[model samples]
Target: MTEEQLDKLRLDGTKVRVVRDALELNDVVGFVVAWDDENVLIRRPNRRVVKLKRSYAIVPASEPRPDVLTEN
Candidate 1:
């Protein structure tokens, strides 16, 4: 598969996978493990198990700025 395909797979809404980062939730933070077909297995910010699928999207965390600083 092409690199683009792989990236799409990672971001596809129907794709089943884990989010490799901890997230914040209402005063806590933790990582998301996997999606349980119906719900997402999130490692609760408080170190507990919680299922949630409120919102999720695969996108670059940061992008290069278009404007550059140059000195003459």
Candidate 2:
């Protein structure tokens, strides 16, 4: 994604599915907390934080749930 897209996601508190490696099926579902040119920090439902390279494929998931929308 472009920096603008990432910035939008970060600002909107949108949930994303991050695909680290398609071959290995490594991915995470969470909302981006912060991002720089090199990396992004995501917080999962369990309150666990994951740091991912900016090159990873990060896409929007389903629409935010009502509770999630209210919480943010």
Candidate 3:
């Protein structure tokens, strides 16, 4: 994402769901804390901060949860 996009997410203080399919990892639901060109820092509900690559997909948490996610 560009700096503008990241700034928007950061400014809104929105909760987001990040998916890392390439790594076969579980989704992370959290708030955007900070970001740079290559990495985004997110703070999870448990207050743990995680650094993720910008290549991963990040979606707004306000959207309806996908059926597949709930079924799991």
Candidate 4:
């Protein structure tokens, strides 16, 4: 994802589709991340470990992050 796209996700709390590694998908998680050039580091839900790019993943709009950390 691009910086602008990440920013938009942060602003609107929108869901984002990403390609991540399968090894990292051991648990259900939601995170807000700043995308880098080739990958991103997203903070896992409940303050869990942050996963780097692995395979493909999708995060919902209702997911929590530093900006929208509270559930509606």
Pick out the ten consecutive residues of candidate 4 with the lowest summed lDDT: 63-72
Q: Each candidate's root-mean-square deviation in Å?
A: 11.3, 9.4, 4.9, 9.7
Error of 1 at 2 (Å): 17
C-alpha lDDT score of every prediction, in listed order = 0.38, 0.76, 0.80, 0.50
Per-residue lDDT tens digits for candidate 2, residues 1-72, read: 777888899899898888665342466888988888899899998999999898766778673222322333
For model 4, residues 1-72, the per-residue Cα lDDT tens digits are: 456756776677554434333343343454555666655656655565465663334455355322222322
Candidate 3 per-residue C-alpha lDDT over 1-72 given as tens digits, one digit per residue, 9 for 90 to 100: 778877898898889888765332477889989988899999999999999998777878888544443334
State TM-scores per candidate. 0.32, 0.73, 0.77, 0.45
Best-fitting candidate, scored by lDDT: 3
Clashes within 3 Å, all models in order: 0, 0, 0, 7
Clashing pairs for model 1 are none
TM-score of 2: 0.73
Q: Is candidate 2 or candidate 4 better by lDDT?
A: 2
Give the Å shift of residue 15 in candidate 4: 6.0
Candidate 4 achieves a global lDDT of 0.50
